[model samples]
Target: MQVRHERPMSELSYQVSAPLKLTLEAGQIVTIKHWSLDRIDYPEAVDILPKSGLLSIPFQGVDIQFFVEFETDTQDTYLKFKNLTGRQRETLAIFYRSILSGKMVSTGDMITSLDTPVDLVPMGETDDEKASDTARASPQFLRVIWNVAFYLILSVVVFGLIGQQIWTRISQVSLMHARVVAPLVEHRNTDAAYVDEILVAIGDEVQRGQTLIRLNLPEHDAKLTDIRGRISAAETRLQALENTRQVHLNTGDPTRRVLLQAYNQTVASLNDRNFFSGRDLDDVINAWHDLRDFDDLARLAKGPFYDILRGLDVEIQAQNDALGRLKRELGNHKDAMDAVDIVATTAGTILQIDVFEDQYIARGMLAITIEENRPRMVRAWLSEEMSQTVHIGMQSRIRFSEAGQTRSVMGTISDIQASIDPDISDDFGIIVSVAFNDMNVTQTRHTFRTNAPVTLSASKDWADFGSLIGLER
Candidate 1:
């Protein structure tokens, strides 16, 4: 078999002296700078080229008809003939060789026209000039910028929400079981007595210095009565001594009256002494001896008047001293009587009454339990996992139900401990004590119970957010 060789078509072009006007479909006019039998060349007018079109060229007073399509190469923009018959190709060849070659195309020369309407399908928007036009029509950069910004903001919001949830979970330590507690003020009786009257019942609100119970203190009462009796007796004895002295004054003997007056003055002076020690008593005895000497000197004339008066003066002084002592004792017994009434030392509500009317109570026995009228506190148990996170003086939030409504208050971690409470039977975890803030105290003063349930929460340090998410070492 013999291999037949075929010839490839030649690529040739020619420049026109004057640009010829070529009109395409859609009235698109382009200036042809170069011409050939197979194609025509023009400056790039649009980014996308028309795929195919029917073209007509006027040559030798007859029109040569063919189909042409746009194409491109490295050097120039041009169109190539397509869908041409052999006869149409030969006609164009003849026309190019004889008349169109080296021709200086002018406005009066051969005119090219497209017959069928060219569909302007978009190819691209990359041409610099056409792209500028498209940009002016609608800004693509701004759209891209806005889209990028929207996605950025959306990402930030999503991360922020996730971070908030994680932070809320880790920043707080919960107490599984907690209660609203207040300090218990125990009212104990220091002296043994019988409860004469129960003035206040359990849960009754009492003010400071208000009597809660009256006791029948038999020993104290007996001692008080005895002191009163002694005081009365002393008063009687003192009045009797005064009467005896008045009797001596009424004797009407001028010398006897004068001597009795002197004796009374001396006794009054001695009675003025607050405390008489052995030496002071000895001095009084010496004064008495001196009075005896005066009496001895007047014995022959006055006949024992001075002696009788001196003895009466001494008796009056003894009654006066006894009255002073009994009165002082009475005053002490009166003070002890005040203690028989068990008055409240502080304002509070009575929690427990251990004794009833006529019940005998011993010294140092708890008579009543009073809950002080003060701010409420929360006692909670923290888990071991949160032991390190919770500490004293940390800020906290406490919540508890009151009158079927939930209420929250700001508080502080006043105390945290691992010790056990002897009063509590169950082993609650680490102890946590929370004190309400001053503003909340006023609102919750009367609302708190000794063992009401409560919940506690605390704020977190934001710098530890990364660590909670495992994003930091």
Candidate 2:
């Protein structure tokens, strides 16, 4: 993107020729075309295209409308917002009106038409000629500027009085503290969640039994299934073995009639040889009994297979026990969540909401705040010497940042802090009270549940303004 800019002091004006062709005078705005506003600070959606081939004029200063036009291409430029403050508002209004009304000549690098009567005077022309050749509306435009200034000055006075009346009822000793803060949480924990968040947010109101985190659970779920499956298999196998044994005892042949003949042969062989007496032949008798039972046949066919099965059963039982213990301890591991009850701990507007949906947040993070709605207070710490002029219940005026718009509560000083701590960064603290005339707007402004430092100014009378102009007090 090529940046084309017209300097403020450039002799060329921002007005154009032809339909709007114009010449410029001192202090006249010149249009800047093809300048990239991509980097310019503006809000999300204010597009002001620098028109091509026309005298350029700065039309917007208030509302922070910006442009980043690309060189020759209409598609490349992005816009930004730069909202003007109240004072800048009036100035830009007059300037923009003059440019749009064709009262000023447009001058810039992208000049499209120079048809305005350019007497073509050389630089060496006499001062009189230069003055006479000036743009026709310069004097009239100057008058418009003066009018804009007049209105602005009047607005300041009105705001001053309003600020004074509002401050008179504010407390002089309200605390203005600053502290580092953490973000709010919105989810639960899981088994994979190894890192535990330790701190909670300052302003978040917490509810009981809220699950704060979620760890990895898929692995745990798989383990549980495996354990239960093994237990069931072991129990079924044990039952099958017991039923087979009972059948063997109920039937002498025991589904092994074919093997009974072998038992008979062994018995006959032992008897014919007279290998031992009845007591000594017990081993031979036991061998014949096994030949008559199917279980005995199965054992002979498979060595230690039953022993292996028994070992597997024991292992399964142990796993089942371990799994049960874990389930009890973790409380199903299904409902863990972190939530907070945002009951109005106090009445006030929600100062801020920290985290947005779907964004991960730390546990116990500040989510929102409720500004205090009470005796209007202007709490400012004063130097030990300055304290001499201040007294309790003395009417005090306050000034808030233009952003603060709390109105409703207003009144008198009813309390004051007796002591001051010099070691503080400000080295002072004071409290002033205003009446409760207004409370509705406190919920909208001047309220904070968590601590965020803000600026406050207080004086005994509405006129006693302080020199410290910076907002963060």
Candidate 3:
């Protein structure tokens, strides 16, 4: 006896009870390879019998099998299938059987089941039973979707509420360059006076009437003394001449008495303090000429007596005129000496000193420059466009940074230049001034330096959205 063995293409194989033969007709059955879903072989109008007296059938690379079974009792042919894997067996059964029985199956249904192989059940489950299981699984999936939707809605609500409280403001921002400025007062001297001492230095604060420099005028004082000495000598000579005239009057010569009395009356009128009001020295000189025509004195005194009296009268008149001239010169010297000390006219800080100690300063020369320290102001220049909107009394903020520290002060717009300055560049536009408030005045004086750079911001009166909404209510 001889035996033969053959291997099936896949794990699944079939065997019949005895040798059987079947007749296959065209279009009666189709054989589809499950893995490739291709019709590898199909039945034709031919007869198939067990080969070599065996009742086994072999397939190539087939995971599922489909066959048309004829039931003799019912006289009906139906589709059936077998598969190796439990997953997707029922769906594949229905799908393949529907094709064999000529029942229409949508391509979408076949593709949908093929795409999701896990949705198919084992071979024993019916289509109605699979539907119940699918219905049972839907609640868990829906709950997961609801949870994701709830989180998304919560996030949107939270962000929307936060955005309502936040605000955004749009403003015109600009950089302002500024400096500290104050009113300046200059003290000067014009006379040729020497600076004996300087009492104040730069950066020193001084009060009103404070002495800044002391001056010495040696030449002026010496000239005054000389004028006083000359006036004293002239006065002494005039007094001696009056004493001599009194002696001549006591001698009782009638002619001499009349001449002497006329001379005395003229001298008395010339010496009177009020004499200069009506008659100048020249008028007194003319009166002396009339008094000199004394023929009677010449007759009374023979030789030398009339000559000596005439000489004495001329000497007295000359001395009195000299004395008056010297006295007027002395008064001018006194005034010059009194103007030596230079004092401040106002309270301020000393900015500069032009003259040094012991230096001779001419009259009308600048000695020191003092700036009023209080009421400091910041000066800035704005563009022509910016100038139109800026006005007096607008709120202002000043910022200054130095040595790693920043300081700020509040102020108000005090002035705006009516016209642009010709000396400054046109790009600088118009000059604007801001006066520091009373509370910050002292702090500004201590922290800010003159001509130091600063930043200034001027705010406009505009309502925000919140404020506008509040106004509506």
Candidate 4:
């Protein structure tokens, strides 16, 4: 390493390994000078004697001392130098060679200094050892780099595989527990009657207009039968009256025939004449009187028979009116009896059967409950916070767990309740309804006892980081 200095002349020291053969007189002084190639502002000078000497060099306003020692008593002269301040060791080596080569003059003129230059070798480890050490460390450095790259590739592959398994596109949404239910159609009776037969039972599928139960109303049936009998009897009596009247008309009496002829002639004359004046009106009155006289004479000739016939006709009319009313009552009674066979008004599965065979069911009593099995719906209650994110028509996933198995189905939010249910707990959740995409309750209708517990999840575009790691918010 090269050391840089900011001073004009810096102190440098080196140990001399070779001996100098000099005929030195005692107390002779030699001057050593230092020149800085980079700085020309100041040159430094130091005076030294052979024995032990101390020299000061000015370096950036600070005086640095150099200690030099020479041992002449030894077989080889040893020179020791100390307190080097600058890193220009090569310059110091050259200066040391000038001394050995006689470039440095002795204070006495008798010793002439040579003007030749020489090179000084520095002391340290050889170049071969440095090359060997560098060669040894190169493989280790390359191995470290290779290991880092290998681990980086391995981490990429490992995390990529793990991400493929766990980092799915599925959104992490709050799951709301829901229930599966079909539309319910309640069957009820309008009149009190005994359950004659139950055509269907719970869990049985029924179609529209299919009979679900049969009720027996004996009293209503008896009333209907009695009304029919009374109607029949009334009709027979009316026929007899008609027959008697026809016989009376066919039988000829001389007084009755003469009176009837005179009445007919009088009525014909009255109809033919126009009573436009007082004389015409008098003639009409006369004709009317004559007709009334004949009618009275005819009635008198027929005597008690005619009176009986007239009374029979009045009685028959009254009986006919009564018969008509009775017939209407019978028809109404028959309709009431027919109502005993309770039929389903819609197609669905029978969720409940309230009445059993021979059971007495009262008016407006529940018979059966049928639930429409198509287009299955799931009702979910979401928390108030979660409900804010949910909306109608959003896609949802429904999970049904039963018998140690879980099945998932896709659906859409069909409806949302306008208000929160008062009966629900303080969780403060609103009800949401979902409709299955293509599935119906018919396939798994039996699985729903009342309301099958389900899990509802709506799809979201993004999720939080904590949720992905299974952390609760």
Indicate which candidate wins on lDDT: 1
The alpha-carbon deviation from the true structure for residue 304 of candidate 2, after best TM-score superposition, in angstroms, is 16
lDDT of 3 at 102: 46
Most accurate candidate by TM-score: 1
Compute each candidate's TM-score over C-alphas. Answer: 0.49, 0.26, 0.43, 0.47
Best to worst by TM-score, what's the order? 1, 4, 3, 2
Residue 272, candidate 2: how far off, in angstroms? 43
- What would the TM-score be for candidate 2 when compared with the true structure? 0.26
Question: What is the alpha-carbon lDDT of model 3 when measured against the actual structure?
Answer: 0.62
| Deviating ranges (above 4 Å) for candidate 3 | 1-175, 191-211, 214-229, 242-325, 336-343, 361-365, 418-428, 440-442, 463-473
193-237: candidate 2 lDDT, tens digit per residue: 222332334444344343222223345557656656755665666
Each model's Cα RMSD: 29.7, 24.4, 28.8, 31.3
Model 4's TM-score against the true structure:
0.47
Identify the runs in model 1 with alpha carbons over 4 angstroms from their true place.
Answer: 1-169, 199-210, 254-303, 383-386, 402-409, 423-429, 437-442, 445-447, 464-473
1-473: candidate 3 lDDT, tens digit per residue? 11222243453232112111222343322332221111112223234411111111221222222232221211122112222233344434444445344455556655554455444556797889878887744577899999999999999999877774442112322425577776679898857799999998998989998888988888876887788888888888899998897676465446545656666676676756657566556645655564465554455664465566777788888888788778877876676665667889999889899999889888889999998766678887777766656788888888889789997778888888855554334564768888887755466667777777888877655743344356641
Ranking by lDDT: 1, 4, 3, 2
Q: Which stretch of 10 consecutive residues in model 1 shows the poorest summed lDDT?
A: 108-117
Off by over 4 Å in 2: 1-320, 332-349, 357-376, 386-425, 429-473
Q: Give the Cα lDDT of each candidate.
A: 0.70, 0.42, 0.62, 0.64
Let me know the TM-score candidate 1 reaches against the reference structure.
Answer: 0.49
Error of 1 at 261 (Å): 22
